[model samples]
Each structure stands twice: as structure tokens, then as C-alpha cells.
Target: RDIAPSDVLAAREAGATGVVLEAGATNSHALILARSLGLPAVIAVAGLLSSVTDGDLIEVDGNSGEITIGETVPASAPVAAGRATPSATRSSAPPVTRTTDGRVVRLYANVGQTADVGVALAAGAEGVGVVRTEFLFLDEPPSEQDQYEVYREMADRLAGKPLVIRTLDAGGDKPLPYLPVAPEANPYLGLRGLRLSLAHTEVFRTQLRAILRAAVHGRIMLMYPMVTNAEEIALANEQLLAARTELAASGEEAGDVAVGAMIEVPAAALRAEALARHAAFLSVGTNDLAQYTLAADRNNAAVSYLYSQTHPAVLRLIQATVTGAHRRGRPVAICGEVAGDVDALPLLIGLDVDELSVAPHSLERVRAAIASLSYPECVARTEAHLRDV
Candidate 1:
């Protein structure tokens, strides 16, 4: 059955224990509420509704993202390409973050929603690479205190692991019904990411305040998405300063916060050094980078083949980004689909990605894979393969 947020409440009022929904609605306001309200949910299964009749028994395992129908086990658990279930693969491997050859590569999780934090941590994420804040506000933005309480709970749960929060990245493909968005000739190239946040300064300010307030609970690093140049980062930082000032006047305590910039746009990747000079850290968003560099829309199957993180050009941008960040003593984290990819592990390690953030489900499999690779061999191979003339 379709479970909207209101439906979650209605279902609860009817004394339903949990809800199973079509995978497509995971980002809906209701699904977010389901998790917030402590209701278990399983999403993204084909033939989900059809498979179950009225009052049929189903087991929704939110942790494993699995749904079992009518006491029958699911035929297979979802797994990453060329990988097995994390539990199946865990063979007494050390929980420490390191490779077999002694190179330390931190494994983080790219959490799409707040409920994902538990799964990511349970899967052994050392820190949070990116919390896609956009998923928190599906239908409309939450009030300041609502945002604060939610973020505060996340920070408290983290209990000291680094949390990098990517401020609301909306517009382009992800237009909000509550907020009006103009039709774009190329929405991907138009007002998106920081551009949209800049357009709605008050909303951004509220988020900033919430994040700032939440920082008091544990480590929190604020970051902006889709930043093209230093000016945008500078302007956004200026607003952050205002948020801090407002908090100070309101007698609120915000922990010492660090600022970061996402190097997604080629312009940002190209001039990463200059931006690094102003940022506390930098992250490479390979998903957007690959699409923008290759002129391919990842969502469109026609150009899907071209939407590869392994392409030489995309690799070079990543190389340049990591090299620049390292030169400036700033750690570079990659929070994209590629980070979770087992095939791209060696290249990312070779590129010297300080942190690899992947989907929660793929975290342990990726960790197992990383533990099997040699840092020295990867660096040598990467240097030879991406040799710059």
C-alpha cells in the first residue's frame, strides 16, 4: 500500500505496527516520518503491493533494506556489483580502518536520510561523509526547531564520529512542489545546489542554525554542494557567520564548526587549490562530475553508458582534486556512487581519496574489499594509468 507521511500517521492510528511501501517513495515526506516516528519500513521492491494481499503478513527489515513476504524468505538480498552480503563476507576481518598493506582509508557512509544513520553505523561507517539534507525535506521544509531536534538526535547518536552535512541541494531534477522551480532548458545546468540555496537565504539560514545547534552534541562539519567557485563558498560562509551571530545573541552554544566545499563542478575541481585555501576540507562528487564532464545525464539510459566514474577524463578531475587537497593539507572525501563501487576502489585509493563514502548497504562489502587491496600496488598502478604528460 502507498504510505504517505499522513498515511504513516493514519496507519499508526489504526494500530498498524509498520509499513511496506513501493521503493520509489522512499524519499517521500511520509517515509521520512515513518522512520522518525520509529516505524519500521522496507522500500524499493518490485511487485511489492501485488505480492501482498489485504492483511497479508510481511516482514520489513529496515536495517538490511529487505522485505519478506508472508513468512517466505526473499529469494535474494540486494548486493553491490561483484560483491556478497557484508555478513556473509565478514570473516573475522578487523574492524579497524586500514588496508592489508597498511594504508588507512576511512570508510564513511553517504546517508540519504536521517533514519539511514543507524544502518550506516551498524554497517561500520567510521564517520558520515555526507548526509544528503535534501532527503530530510521532501514535501516542504521543516520548522527551525523541528530541523534542530532531528539533527540533534543524529549528532547525539553519532557520539563523536565526524559528521559532514551537505546543506540542502535542491532544484534541477529534484524540484520541490512546495517551492516553485522554473522550467529549465537544462535543469542540471541551471539554478541547483548552492545556487538554489542562495536564492532562498532565509531557508538556508534556518538550516544553518539547526546544524549549528546540533553541532553541540558532537563533531559536525558544514559543507555546501554544487559550488562552482570561491565566491559562492565565500558568500555561503558569510551567511553561516550570520547564523552563528544570531545563535550567539539567542544564547545558544554551537561547537567549533569546520567548513567544507564540494568539488563537483569541473570549474571547482579545476581550481580546487584556490578553493581549498578557503575551505577546511574538500569533497569530490563524482556522480555529478562524471555527468558534467562527459555531457551525459546519468538518469537517461541513452547516455547511461557514458556516465562512468572510470572514464579517463573524470579520473583526471578526481586526481587533480585529491592532489590539490593534499597539497593544502586538506583531506578529500568522495561521496558519490563511485565511492561505493568495488571496481573504482583501487583508482580512488590511487587518487588518494582520504575517505570513501558509500551507500549504507554497501559499506561493509566495500570495507572488506579495501582490506584486500594493497595501497602500494594501487598507488603505483594509478600513477602509471593516470600519468600526466
Candidate 2:
């Protein structure tokens, strides 16, 4: 799919009416390709298979989960009516909000629950960026079988699209009573993410094995949360190797897996250049970064407002983190509250962010926001904003 852009354009040039694709591939790369090719696309809801055929001339009603096939009437199964294709609706062409200049940006959504998949598609998200897999384990310490079932269900919903499955980020704010973690004076800065995973070796290994196992069914990327240093990333990878070795000994098969790190802690963000060399990719958890940098507790009402994404310090940290990752020729994405903020959205685009993974509810607006500006305008605004910060 490296030449996917040209492929799409060729299809349009050949007079193809519409196209259907998996959700994950619908990110900025795919979206830009679609716009450039002038081909209207319909992304499936909840990773459901789209009924559009090559010659169907089908109408994709994204808002209502409907795809109308040919014949005098619309086909019922997984197809509906009253839905306008994205390109069709935009044919009239209205002025949009872009960077102070004008370059299109791409936006995505981060999913968690089963329902989020459909919501994201309906919101016009190109795809899901990060799927926090810990929620699947929190209900009860999921047995290995239970983990497999949940992963399978998630994979099915994601279809053939890319799903960045972050291995369980236990302890701290999201503590599991079954797996006890000792209290710390600073829980936020405590043994969370890879640190906790390493301490609870069994839990860590189980989750890693579960992810690797699930990768067989769909396009999957493995991510480590709350990673602060290269050693932590190495330790997580070591445990992953251990899991694979154990599986191989058991004669079980594992699928392709890419190990990446979460740049949340200031330390991790600052060291992103070195860390990216080890990680396949990088994603910033701006919520925690904001809290950590501003000395504000996200859960505390007293200083919650101080946990501002627009703050100069917070923006600078994010810019630095993105710069560090890009310098290493690695792609980095943002999966934080700021990703959905309309005002902050432009700022992030300006910062040269590779992806903006936001909530499902904000997808269409975010995409439209990004589409309004050009890359050059965003870069200039981003530079000026960073300087002001």
C-alpha cells in the first residue's frame, strides 16, 4: 500500500464511482490520498464489512451506518439509505477553518470500549489510532482464555485495519484489586506502565502473549505505556521475548508484533530521540504529560484547570517530544484530551504532529478542521506558536 496514493488516483481516473476500505488505513495518509484522487470513500462501522462492490455505485451513509446498493431499492443487510457520501456532501465546497495559513491536517480517534468502534466510524474518523487493551483486563483479572476472547472480539470489530494494542497499563489510577500494588507517595510517578509490568512478571508476560496471539487475526501494533527510559522499553521487550519463547516451547504460534513506547513522563519525552531508536514508533500521552509538567493532579479538583493542554510549558514539552521522535525518522502520534480540542487542534497540526488521536465524538470536526489548512500554513503557525510558548 506504499503506492496506495497513486492506486487511489488511478481508480478515480479510471472512473470508479466510490471506494471501501478498512478503518485503520483511513488515517491521514489514506484520507489525503482519497481527496487527491477525488474518490469518495466509505469506512466500515465497528469494522463491519462494507457491502460496496466495484461497480455498485453505492451510497455510503456514514451517519446512519447505511450503504445503499443498486436496484430500484436499497439492500437491507449492512446497508441503509438517506446517507450522503463524504465527497458528495463536500462537492458544494464551503470555506473551512484551517491554520492561520492553509494546509490540510489529518485527525484520528483513540478507541477503548466495543461501542467506540462504531462511534468512531460514524464520527467520520479515518481510523482508530490507539486501543487501550487494559479495560479488557480490569473487569476481572482475565484468565488467559478470557484475554483471548476479548482480543478476538476487538480484532473482529477492527476488521483488517491497524489497531495499536497497548498492553495492560496497570496500577496507579487504574489499579486492579486482584493484582495488589503497594501504595506510593507519588502514585502517578510510581511503578506504572513498564515498571509495574516488569514487577508483575506473570501479568506482563500474559498480556504480551495475548497481544502477540491476537495479532494473527488483524493488523496490530504493540505499545508499552508509561515508558520512561530505554531500559524500561528493553525490559518490556525482554519479557515479550520470554513470552514468545514460552509460547514456542508450547508449540504455539505468534503473529507479527511491533514494540513501541508511550512518551508521557517528561523524562521519556526528553529522551524520545534515543528511545525511538529502540521503539518501532512513539505516541505521546499528553494528559499525563500535562499533569506531570504542571504539577497538577488530573483527578484533583483543586488544580485540575491547571492541567491545561494549551499551557506554554505543556505545548513546549509536546513539541520537544515530537521533534525528538521525528529526528530519529520515527512517526509519533498524540493520544490525549488535547487531540479533541477544537482550538488546540490547529496548534497541534502546526506542531507537525503525525497524528491526532482523539475521542470518537470529535472525529468529523477534527478532520474538517485539519482539512481546512495546508501543511505549510500549519508549519508556520506551529513555529510561531512554539516561539510564543
Candidate 3:
């Protein structure tokens, strides 16, 4: 069964030590929440519910995705080979990370809530990479005032650090109860993100107004999700301008905010240059981009093997996105699970991404990995990887 983001948070509050789900994608919001909360989670466990009874003692090894049942292990039992035991301690990362060749890479945290901000700051995150605003609209869309309070609180907590707040990304995988949506055979490829926002102008405008109001408290950058074309960016910006105008007419003041686009669709990636003309910056959502590029559903176990962000095709899109944004003098950021991958650090740096936004828990490790890499070598490696593509 599919798990929600709030469900993961509730489980943590209820004293659950680990989570096992029969279904979920690696990039799913639930799994992301579990990771941010430091909860051990293993998803896509076939027959997980049927295999165990209520009273069965279960031991879960999240690192290895191993679930042991019906036996109590001795204290001296040997740990599985190649599997590292989980530790409660968190290592401190440097405030800044630079490549061996002296190129600096910005590291930010992808957070779902305000509480995650403290953890991200402690782990040396330069700023908040993205705040998944959809978490506040799960059951029902919150009132504009309520949304403003949450966004304002997040900004105040961050002080002057950049806060990249993504607009409500509902519809696919996360449909709002209050907002009726016609069922679709393939929701991921259907109305979602910016498409859904555009379809429901009232809801989208409400969110934009709140984000604009909250920007007064601190540095805030508004990012629209799932934008596929220059036209989508223009449409979203129109809504934003309307929100600003409404606020002005009401004698309410709003802070300045930079508008950006999320490049999650392959079509968007292919036309990144065109999108850059309308957006202040571009952030690549590699998880969705990879799946959409490969025509693989990330949530489906059958096609999971095909969802590789490092695939040549996916890399080409990333390269094109960076090239396009840079051409327009707009910076590009990678705010996906791929950004946190230690093995992919060199490729990302070589791709010349301006920022890397990963889970809060991965900030330290990713920073350390980047500090050890030579920018020149990374660039060469990236060139080699893109040579045939």
C-alpha cells in the first residue's frame, strides 16, 4: 500500500523504530520523510504484510533491505558482511565545501517541514534547497493565512538563508481530498505539478500569495514544479504577478522573490534554454526526469531497474539543462536523490551544477565527498560520459 508523508512523521512520533512498506518509490515523499527523520525504512518488500503475524518478532536491517523473522538474535551475533550498523550520531560537515581544484559547490537541504531546518543547519547546509509545500495540503488545502504562517515561520527560522519553496505539487501520487480529480490510467504522466496548478488557478493563486507574503520575513525563492515548457513558466509567472497585484491592492506589502522552474520532465529538459528565458533559475528534479526520460515508472518495481539517473540519456538531459540555463546567465541546481549520491558527486560537479540540494541527513556525507574531488578531473569525466550521447 502507498504511504503518505504525514504517515511517516506520525510513525516517528509514535515511537516506531523502523518502517517496512509493501510499495513505494525511492524518491517517494514518504521515503524522503523517513530519511529526513532518521528513521530506518525499507520499501517495496514483496508480501511484507502477509508473511508476518501480529505477534511475530521482526528484525529489519534497513541498510541491506533484510527482514528477519521468528528468531531472536544473540547479542554477539555477527553483523552481515558489507552491511554497516546504523548509528545515532551525526557527523558535522564544514560550513563550505570546495573541490580540490578550488571550485566551490553549494550544498543545501531538501526538507519537508520546518523542524527539518534545524537538522539541516546543524549538518552544514548552506540554505534550504526546497520546501515541499504539498505536505501542508495533504488532507485539505490549508487557508491562505495558515499557509502564510507556515512559510513565514520557515523563513524566519532560516534567518537570511535562501529558502527555495516549491509550490503545491498535487494531483499525481498526491491528490488533494477537497480538490476532486478525475482518475487517470497514468497519473504520473497526467495532470500534476504545474499542470495541476494551472488547472486550478484559485488554489495556485492562494499559494503564490502566501509565498509572496512570507518572503518579507527572509530570503525566499518561489519554484514551480513539473514545468514542461516556456509557456508553462510564463503562465505560472502570470499567476504570481496577479497575486502580487492583489496583495498591493489590499494595502498589503510583499517581499521580492525570485521565480524558478523545476525541470522534471524530459520535454522541459530538452527545452531548458527556452524555460530559462522566463525563469530566474532552473532546478533539475533528477528523480522524475530519469523516470520520464527512460519511460520507466519509479514507483513500479517491474521498471525500477530502468530508473537510473546516471544513464547516458538522463545525463544528456542534465547536461543540456545546465548548458541552457548557463547560456541565459541563470544558475542551475540539482535537487534530487541523485545529488546526495556520493558516487555521482564527480559527475554532478563535472556537469557544473551550481547547487546540490539533498536530504538533510546526506548533507554532511555529500559535502565531504565534494571536498575530496578535483573539479578538473570531474569535468573531464563528465565530458567522457557525454561523448557518445
Candidate 4:
């Protein structure tokens, strides 16, 4: 029998923090559920069960398909030398993602918890890319005041470092039993992300109120996920304005905060200019974009071959997004697996993406890669279809 979303839910309910799936199950519903739950998972691992015995300590890195067993380990995960995390220890501040030719690229980290901030910062993350706020509601959502404190502490911990907080992005692959989430025929193409927020006004508003209140602590940025068009951005902003008004009436006001949109769906990416009109920034969530564009799930090992960021179509959309955002004076940051991908880096640089937000572990190598290559060469190689090396 194949695994289902319920299977992942059961694992989570049973307190399993991660999952290792067979090779063919990469794009399966179970994998989607694992990501939705923020549980670490390594997909399509060859001979996974045969290689492991019960009670053996195992670490699964979803970013890199590396599996480790036993307590003996290296001082750090694999990363290239030169301005690397360990090697960069001589400097007081983390180095920005920059090239050998004196070009600078901003690199941020995607964090789930507050402690993740320090680790990312230590690894040279310029800021926190995207914080999936859905985790705040996994075991019964927190009270508004409770969420405020959690968000406030995160800001305090960052201490002026930038933080991009994505509002609740539940539905489709992720459903909340505590909330009214009806089963759908095609969940991915159905309600989720920003769409879910607008549909569930109260839930969205409460999160906004908390985020707005917490904006006083750091360089906090509000991002709406899976936004498809200009209207959604506008409607979401209306709610935000009301939240601000409510806080004002109570004599406490949230400081200036920049609102942004996630360019994960094609509709948003295509009409980027329209969306940019209202958003202060645009971030591309390439994980969903790749799957949606290719019509193949990354978890489905059978068709996973079709899921590629290198495809010209995907690159075209990315190029279009960056061009549109820059035209409107808004910066675009890529916050997906592709952002951290070494092979995909040059193409991204060619496309002129403004920022890259990756997992903390990828910070060092990505920085090193940037330092190793000149931006002009990356662009020329990509343009001429020549080997980047």
C-alpha cells in the first residue's frame, strides 16, 4: 500500500519528527504533508529500510539527500573552503554573499524556530528569509497575545536583522482538522496559502494583528504566500489596514512594515508588474513553482525527472519576474531549494535575482561559490550555453 497524507499525519501524531520515503514516493501526498508539518524528510532514498535498524540514531537532511547514522560525525556538514563558515570565523560579522569581482549578493536563511535565527546568523545569513507561520497553529493555534510574544521575541533576537514572516499557508497538502478545511478533489490547485487566509478572515486577521504588533522589534517583513493576482494582494492589504486601525484605536501602533507577495504561482509570476504595484517586494518560492510549471510532483520519483529548475520555461518565468520587479523598483528574492542549489546558482545570477534565501547549512558553500565566480562570467556562460566551470 502507498503512503497517504493521513500516514504522514499519523507519524506526526505519533511524535515522529522526520520521514524517509522510498524513491518513487517523492512527489506523493505523504511527502507534501511532511513539508506542511515542517517535519524533516529525505525522499526516495535507495535501499533505505534495508540499510537501517531500529534504535539507530539517524539524521535526515532534506536539503542534501545525505543520511547519517551513529554518534561519530564531522565538525560540520560538507561545504567548500574559502570564506566558508568555519574559515570565515576570523571575521566579527558574517560576510554577505559576494563575488570575487566585488559584486554583492544578499543571502538569507529560512528558519522555523527562533533559535534558528542564531544558527543562521552564525552561518552568515543576512536575514531570515521566510518563517512559515503555519507552525504556530499545528497543535491548536495560539492566542493572539501568545503569538505576539513569540513573534516579539523572534524580533528581539534578530535585533534589527531582517525577518520575512509568511502568514498561515495551510490547505491543499496541509489541512487543519481543528479548522474547517473541507477535502478537495485537487488540493494543490485548490485553496491554500493567501487564498485560505482571505477565505478564513478571522484566522488571517489575528495573525496579521500579531505580526503588525511585533513589527516594532526588528526589520520585519510581511509576505503573503501563493498570491495569484493583484486583487488578492489588495484584498489582503485591506485587512491589514483594518488591523492597523484597530491597533491605533487601542493606543498601540505597529511601526512601518513592508508588505510583500510570494511569486510561486504562474499567474503571479506572469502578472508580476501588477502585483508589484501593491507589494513592496516579491519573493519566488521555487519549490512550488517548479512542480506547478512542470506539472510533475518533486516527490514522485517516477516523474521527478520532469521537475527541474533548469528547464528553460522555469528560467524564463524567473527572468520575467526579476525584470518586472526591478522595473517597478521592487527587489525579488528567491526562497526555495533552487536558491541554494549550486548548479542553479549561475543561472539565477544570470537572471539577475536580487537575493537568495537558503537553509543555514547552505550558507557557507553558496557564499564560497559566489566568491569563486565573477558575476560577468556567470552571465556570459549562461547566455552562451557554455560550461560555467
Candidate 5:
């Protein structure tokens, strides 16, 4: 053992205690040397550290891989040998959207993968606000039935809860390697979402077929993203109708599915009232709204920090979109990273958002925050905070 000769010296100098060593690639000699020094030691479990982030005051249950942050109680906490068995706990309960008066607001998760569907439900999501079906069409494209199977599995797990599926939003940053899309210099400004899906008829047809197929099994709605004009909505409805016609010909009934669009771009946000006239609901993708509104590329690290959801201009647009949707009797939800921030929650509550979709990890913390503040206080505080920001 390399450190055997200096084990005592290391102890004296380093103030040694029980060492936690990663076993996968840890040097055996080092373990032996630490053992010689009479240091208590243990091997690191795979994936243990990966889940924990820096600056997170995390309570980790080694036995369950459960990590709780903020005020949320984790499902379980780690216990040492002979210690009392810890009661089952979760890092936090699912998040609740709060009104200014402290009324519970519906908060859901915008899931991308089937695996995430369970996580969102377990985290206390009211429903899956959004399911980007694009992930299903990656490489080695699965059959239409295969897509239906995945969607049905997720729908079954959600069990009567609202699940909004956005048909294949490919191209741009999410190009399919298998589908020969020529590299665009400005992919973000290029064809994507409903446009990409429509241009490629077979691709859009297959997705619509899969989604309609899954609709028979659950409470489902169809939504499109990156919409700019009314024609896109008209065209999208035509395609969906064609899908329904085809499914009926095949002896499969196309169940009722509400159609909607995302209000992300400035044009869409401006025309939200008109967009709502044609669609069932409107979801503001704040992530893209901020980027496109501020003319900032989120991926550009140089200016990424300047991306501010707190920007008054961006706030105005979001409020306008929410207000417009409500006026038209169309529900509005936000699916973005901002939904997870406790500070932003109040602002959102004040804005009268119908729902919020956030990451699973931040769910409980948000719930606790919501439970702590009344809607009036939240709005008052948000109003005051906006001035300072």
C-alpha cells in the first residue's frame, strides 16, 4: 500500500475520519492504506452522487436513492446500522399552484419520456400538461403502433388525468438523424413544430395516428407549438381530421381530443386572443418566450446570463398572453424552468396562470412555498419585487 508508510502522518495532518471511497475505480492500495491507518471506510454506490447537485441542502437516503431539498421531506432518509428505522418520507409532496388568497393551484409536469410520466405522477402532478411526442421518433423509428403503445402506457399510468400530447415537434434543435433535414444556420428560426410535422406528411400522419389511437384510452388533448398564424391552425385541424378519417376507415374510433397551440413567439403571444378563437387552450413556453422576446439565444453562454424572466418586457408579454387566454375562456398553463423557482411562483400566481408545469425535483419545494403564501400577499410581494428587479 503506497500510503501505508504515511498513514499515521496522514491522520495527524488531514484530521482523518471514516472515508467514503468510490469502489468502481478506487485504488485497492489506497483502501488498504486507509484500513491500516484504522480509518473507518465504505465504498461509494453507483449513481449516488449523480443525483445530488452542489449548493443543494439535500437529505439523502442511501438505501432508497431518495433526495429531498428545501422544505420538502424526502420519501426516506438514510439510517445507520442499529438505528431506528426511518418512516417513509418523500423529499416533498407534489407541487400546488397557489392563488393570491392561498388557494391550491393545479401544477403538472411537462414530460418528454415515458419513464418521466411515472415520476411526474409520483411527484403529485395534477396531470401531464405536455408530452412532447418528438422523442418517440428519434432513430430506428418505431412503428405507429409502437408509438401508440408508449403513449397508452403513459396514459394508463396517469389514469384519467389530463395528458396533452404535442405532435412531433422535430427539426430545429431537435432534428431527427434518420430524417434527412438539411442543417440550417438558424435552426431556431427555421421550420419546427407544426410546420415540420405538416411539411413531412408521412411523419405528421404517423404521429397523429398514434396520438388519436392513444386518445381512446385516456383523457387526452392535442396541442401544436411555434404557431404564428391562423392558417397553421386551419391546416393542422385539416390534417387531424384526415387522421380521424383514416382511423375510422380502419375500424378504430377517434375519441374526442381538444386541440390547442403554444404561445411562445411574440407574434403568437400578440395574437393569443385570435389563436384561442381557433384552439381549445394556450400554453406559454416561457423558456422560448424569454429567448425570442429578448432576442437572446439561450444556448449562447456568453449572453445566457442576460436571459431574464424578470424582465418587465417579458413579464408584460406573459401577462398579456395569460389575460388574453382567460378573456377567450381558454385555459393557460406555463411549462418552463421558471415554474420551478420559488420566487417566480408568486409572480405566476399573481398573473392568474391556470396551471404550472415544472421539473419533478422542484415539485415539493414549490408546493411548500405555495402552501406558505396567500394569493394576495403573493401578488403584492410580486408587484413590489418587480419594481426592484
Candidate 6:
């Protein structure tokens, strides 16, 4: 069965060595958490539950997606064949990567919790791109002070690196136990992200206020998810202003924070020009954008073949977003699974993406890929891909 991000965290705390999920997308929050915590995981394993029982002595190979069941296994057998073991002597990549043609690209880490901050820094991440804040509201909504402590600690640990904190993106695939969300036929398209925040102004304000307060500790950027139109950004800014005013009236100090928007919906990508006018920066959520653009449920196996970030339609949308944002002199970032994909690095770089926020474990690989490419070649490849479209 599918697991939640909080469940992944709890499993880590319980000292679990690995995770096996019957169903989950590779880019799902739970799996992302698993990677962040360094837990070996294999998902979408059919018959996983029906074939195993408690104390079956099953061996799981996350890299190969192979499971062996027996009374005992050879201790000398390698779990992942040919996989390089972590070595202390491994050279660390630079925080920022420059292509052979002198184009610079920033590599950031997508973290889920405060603990992931140190790991990101150690992995040579230039900054923390997007902090998934839903983890704090999984069990129950945290008080403003509680949220403040976590956000502040993350900023403090970053030690002046830019930390982009995304507000609570709950209500759809991720539902909070404490918040009542009416069941809908299509939760993905239902009230979620900014819509959910707008519907619950108090909760939204509390989060904005906490983020604002945390800004005083270090460089912080506030990003809102699922913003489909300029009006949504305007409405969100209204709440942000209200939070700032409330903080000032209470004599609570707040620092300057840049506001950004996540372009996940196709509509948002098409209107990136307008959205760029409202947001300070734009980050592409290719996972949702690909699924939404293709009308393929990412979590559904039957339609999985249809879901691709490289598809011409998806690539055009990303190009449009980058083009639109650049017109307004706003930076654009890719913070989805494709950002870390070595094969997709050329495409993104060719499309002129400014930053890539990937899982911490993928930092070195992505950096290497960026260093091996030529900006002019990437641009030619991108043009070739978009030629007939």
C-alpha cells in the first residue's frame, strides 16, 4: 500500500533499514523522504504483500528491485551488484557547476526536514531549493511557534544559504488528519495547495507568519504551490501582507522574504508571463506538470507510459515557462524528479533553467553531468527537440 511522508519518517525513527511499497510513484513524497533519510526503498512491487509473511527472512535489493525469501541468506552476497560504496576519500563537487561553454547552473537540494539540511550542505548543495512543509502538518497542525522553531532551525543550519520554504501543500494526495477535507472524485484537481490555503486563511496566515519570523534567522524564500493564475498569487500575497502586518503590530521582528510561485499546472505554465509579474521567481514542478499536461495519472501504472517529462508537449511548456519568466528577469528553477535525472540534464540546461533542486543523494551526479555538457550543444539539442512542435 502507499505510504505517507510522515509514515516514512516514523519508520526511520523505528530503526527500519529499508522500505518496500506495493504502490507509489518514484517521485512521491514518501519515496523522497526515504531517499532523504537514506533508506533503501523499492516501490510498485506487485504481489509484495501476498507473497510474504512476518519473519519470512526476505532479502530486499532496492537498486535491483529484487526480493529473495529463504530461511537464511549468504552474508557475503552483495545487495547491490556493481554499486559503488560510499568512500571517505571521494572528492566533493563544487556547490555551483559551470558548463564547458561557461554557462552557470546552481544545484540545490530538496529537503523534507531540518535534519536533511546538514546532509544537503555536505553533499555540496549551493542552497536548499524547496523545503516540503507538509511533513509538519501530517499528524496535526503545528502551532505557529512550533512551525517557527522548525523553519528557524532549518534557516539557521543553512548558515546563510538561500532556503526556499514551500507553504503547506496539503488537502489532495496528502491529507492532514486534523483538517477536514471533503472527499472528491479527483483529489488532484480539487482544492489543494494555494486553494486549500485560501480556503483556510487562518492556517495559511499562521504558516506565512512563521516563515516571515524565520526569515530573520537566515536567507529565506517563501514559495506557494499550485498557483494556476495571477489572481491566486494576488490572493496569496494579500494573506502574506496580512501576516506581515500582524507580526509588526505584535512587535515581532520579521525580515525580508522573496515570494515565488510553483508552476505545476499547464494553465500556469501557459500564463507564466502573468505569473512572473506577480512572483519574484518561478519554479517548475515537472512531476505534476507532466501528469497534468498529459492527462495521465502519475501513480497509475496503466497510464504510466504516457507520463513523461521529455514529451514535446511537456518540454514546450517548460520552455514557455522559462521564456516567460526570463522576459520579466525572474529566475526559473526545476525542482522535480527530472531535475536530478542525468539524461534530462542536457534538456533542462538547453532550455535555460537557472537552478535544479534535487534530492541530496543526487547532487554529485547532477553536478558531474552539468560539468560534462556544453551550453551551445545543449541549446542546439533543445532546439532540435522543439523543432517540429
Is candidate 1 or 6 superior in lDDT?
A: 6
Candidate 6, residue 332: how far the Cα is off, in Å: 0.2
Q: List model 4 lDDT by residue over 1-389, tens digit each.
A: 24656566666666576777655355454654455345677766677778776665677787787778665335554422211133433345445667778778899887655655666777777888888676545657667788888888888877888989999877765576545667778888888899888998887888888999999877899999999999999999999998888889998868678999999898788889888999999999887888899998656567877888667777778878998999899999998777777888887887788899876667777887877888898898667643321
Q: Where in model 3 is the C-alpha error above 4 Å?
A: 55-57, 70-92
- C-alpha lDDT score of every prediction, in listed order: 0.78, 0.68, 0.84, 0.77, 0.70, 0.86
lDDT by residue (tens digit), candidate 2, 244-274: 8988899878888877888889888888899
Descending-lDDT candidate ranking:
6, 3, 1, 4, 5, 2
Residue 377 shift from truth in candidate 5, angstroms: 2.0
Question: Model 5: per-residue lDDT, tens digit, 89-147?
Answer: 34355345554465777888766567667666666777888786655445656678898
User: Which 10-residue window of candidate 1 scores lowest in summed lDDT?
Assistant: 77-86
Itemize residue pairs with steric clashes in candidate 4.
Answer: 23-44, 26-299, 26-300, 27-299, 27-300
Using TM-score as the measure, which candidate wins? 6
**Candidate 3 per-residue C-alpha lDDT over 1-389 given as tens digits, one digit per residue, 9 for 90 to 100:** 66877787676666566778888888776787677666677888889888876545567787798877766546565533221222313544566779987898988999887778877887778899899888756777788899999999888888899999999877776777756678899889898988988989998999899999999999999999999888888899899999999999998889999999999999888899999988999999998899899998877777888889888899899989999999999999999889989999899999999999988878778887898899989998988987877
Total clashing pairs in model 1: 2
Model 3's TM-score against the true structure? 0.91
What TM-score should be assigned to candidate 5?
0.74
Which candidate, 2 or 3, would have the higher lDDT against the true structure? Answer: 3
Candidate 5: minimum summed lDDT over ten consecutive residues — where?
79-88
Question: Candidate 1's residue-wise lDDT over 1-389, tens digit each?
Answer: 45444456566557666667665344344554464444667765778867877655576677688877775334463322221124523435455678788899988877756766877677777778888777667676788898888887778778899899899888765666655667789888998889888888888999999999999888999899999999998899899999999999999987778999988899889898989999999988887888899998755544666777778789899888887888899999988777767878998898888888777777777888888999987888777777653
RMSDs, each prediction?
6.8, 13.7, 4.3, 5.9, 12.8, 3.3
Off by over 4 Å in 6: 70-92
